[model samples]
Target chain A: MNYPNGKKTNNKPVTNRKPKQTPNFSNRGMTLEEDINQSNQAYLSSGRAVIHKKPTPVQIVNVDYPKRSAAVIKEAYFKQASTTDYNGIYRGKYIDFEAKETRNKTSFPLANIHEHQVEHMKKVCEQDGVCFAILRFSKLEETYFFPAKKLFQHWDRQNNGGRKSIPYQTIQQEGHFIPLQYHIRIDYLSIIDEMYF
Target chain B: MNYPNGKKTNNKPVTNRKPKQTPNFSNRGMTLEEDINQSNQAYLSSGRAVIHKKPTPVQIVNVDYPKRSAAVIKEAYFKQASTTDYNGIYRGKYIDFEAKETRNKTSFPLANIHEHQVEHMKKVCEQDGVCFAILRFSKLEETYFFPAKKLFQHWDRQNNGGRKSIPYQTIQQEGHFIPLQYHIRIDYLSIIDEMYF
Candidate 1:
């Protein structure tokens, strides 16, 4: 259809023009990241668990201090992280792990993980810390909790001519898969209880 | 003695050019922060321990990922952290704690710590993790590891009309005071082996 100004318009009514992306503030809806972050915060606030995501590594070269309370990080470069994504105390044990999301339907590719992260996980396990990776397939809307040991086995086999990814069937068979609930977004510890404890 | 500007009558001046202000960098080749960073890295690299100073918490407001590997953190703000400075793995146990430096000779004022950090330490201890604080006296160039159990007692007693800060005498008597050595740099794990393990 043409408007008076001769601009063509789709006759269909425009109820939803698309949502503007919001920042960390929860004003907008929450994503999986936000849900886990809130759950972690709830854990901390209630003295249940003390877990936190290490901030994304950034090599801050220049900082502008317009005000003492607020320093603007300027001219910063991203740095490769040397450790896992999340770590903290849970039920008298140290918990450390990485979280990844894949859209693939068949399997989780090993390329999603980095060499340093694997090494970090190995060290954490050796140090008697509970280490693992949380894999979420958004397409499947399913999450799986695979202990670092399993991931290590798969990682090592990749070097020995095995597939460079963990097949979904193998993961379902060997991994302690976690179910997502509304309140507990990731709800990983539940699986840990059944698997480890 | 008078020295002419153009004519250096005397090769040696009575008052040598005010000895170049010992550069902040020269007086100490590396800042205390740098030294601690290097020590922590060595700990992580050698698999002796895994300790890291949490990067300053940044609230990422915007990002420009012009390339796949280059997700530049464009605008961010530094947020005050609620927990301690450093934490990691040591001796098959989860180690979590903070580091503080003070120039005060009489006492390391409790004001150096926040209420939230003390609470975090307590939670870490309850989880059966190793939690402590590394105190450094910049004036004396000394470092000490004060266990969380002892720290919690002092922290709690403050609510019952006790001293706010643990005095240096008490720290020396109760805490495992780590002696500064040339090669060891902030050798804390040795004390851990002797005291805890």
Candidate 2:
């Protein structure tokens, strides 16, 4: 099949390309987490922002210390995080958010977020920090920046028999679509600059 | 030996004390990390501040999944963190800090801090985020909240053949001494309120 850009899509691998002309592997099949991490690194290097993905929480059950080697974790379990995935300072403002990708094309599932995370976001908002979620429609290759306030409004309505998931149409209308740039792959902060700043 | 309050200090276990009269295990022999965690928890519950210790980073090497049981992390190693231990929003400000304890009575050794952490703190400071270090003199039973700006000044001087460690006198004079409270424990935020607000 030919792409709109006139490039053929085929299973056969191209082997004639020179090493200098090789495509950037970092961007290929890159997960949202990897893209954000690289973008955060770019921001850090350029002094644009200081943000980091919090380490995955783990409960270590056992460890083994050899006589002359690094300590090895023998057994462990993943622990549910009490806060969002990403947080830091941006333009003198406290920035906090969680990022999730959904395969569904119609709506973003509420189950993807935890109750504690919602509570944490509410606390951050109460403290006047800029809090939000980066929801990626993986199948569509589109991403949206949804503010915490809007998320809370929907979450609160869940008890009142509101829709359990955020419809794609609502997200398309209400959410800020993040433009994928070459350097700043996920330029969500630009949206933040426009919305909050 | 007798304490100043006339309480006897004995190695002998007190068998006469009732279970209800026993001290809270959470507070006894608690490390600085535990104290801050408890304090953060108190602050969180009281609607005062929202802070959390970032999870200890771990690099998972292998995992085993049984048919019906939970997946088990069979092999892993602790990964060095790229950021500070604790960070969150507090009263419309980004709060970022690292907590350290030293047995040394006269100085806080700069070697305890990594070069990357210093850089991270510098970035946070540049963004106007409130950043600092919580230094605990365990032997002296004292903790001090040292501002990041002050830390940077000392850090920069080391390159010019200045002192490699912060003198006890300097910390005592420049850093805010956080008094250990009965319920609140490490009341460092009180000092923050006094300084920042």
Q: Give residue A34's error in model 2 in angstroms.
A: 1.3
lDDT tens digits, residue span B1-197, model 2 = 33344554333221211112113222347789989998999999998989999999999999988789878899999888888999988899999999999999999999888888998999999999999999988877777889999999999998679989999888887787775555677777877887888
Candidate 1, superposed: residue stretches over 4 Å from native: A1-31, A67-69, B1-32, B66-69, B156-164
Clashing pairs in 2: none
Q: After superposition, how far is residue A3 of candidate 1 from its true place, in Å?
A: 49
**Which residue pairs show collisions in model 1?**
A92-B127, A127-B92
The deviation in Å at residue A195 for candidate 2 is 1.1
What is candidate 2's lDDT per residue for A128-171, written digit by digit as tens? 99999998888777778889999998888985898899998777
Tens-digit lDDT track of model 1 for B1-197: 23223332322221222222212213144345665676777777788887778777777787778866767777887876777777788876777878887888878888888888987788788778788888766665556678888888888888688887788877776676554333345567776776676
Candidate 2 segments exceeding 4 Å error: A1-28, B1-28
Task: Write the residue-wise lDDT of candidate 1 on A1-197 in tens digits.
Answer: 33344554332211111212112222224455665687788777777788888877788777788855677876677788888878888887788889887889999999999999998899888888889988766666656678899999999999799998999888777676554433445566665665557
Q: TM-score of every model?
A: 0.79, 0.86
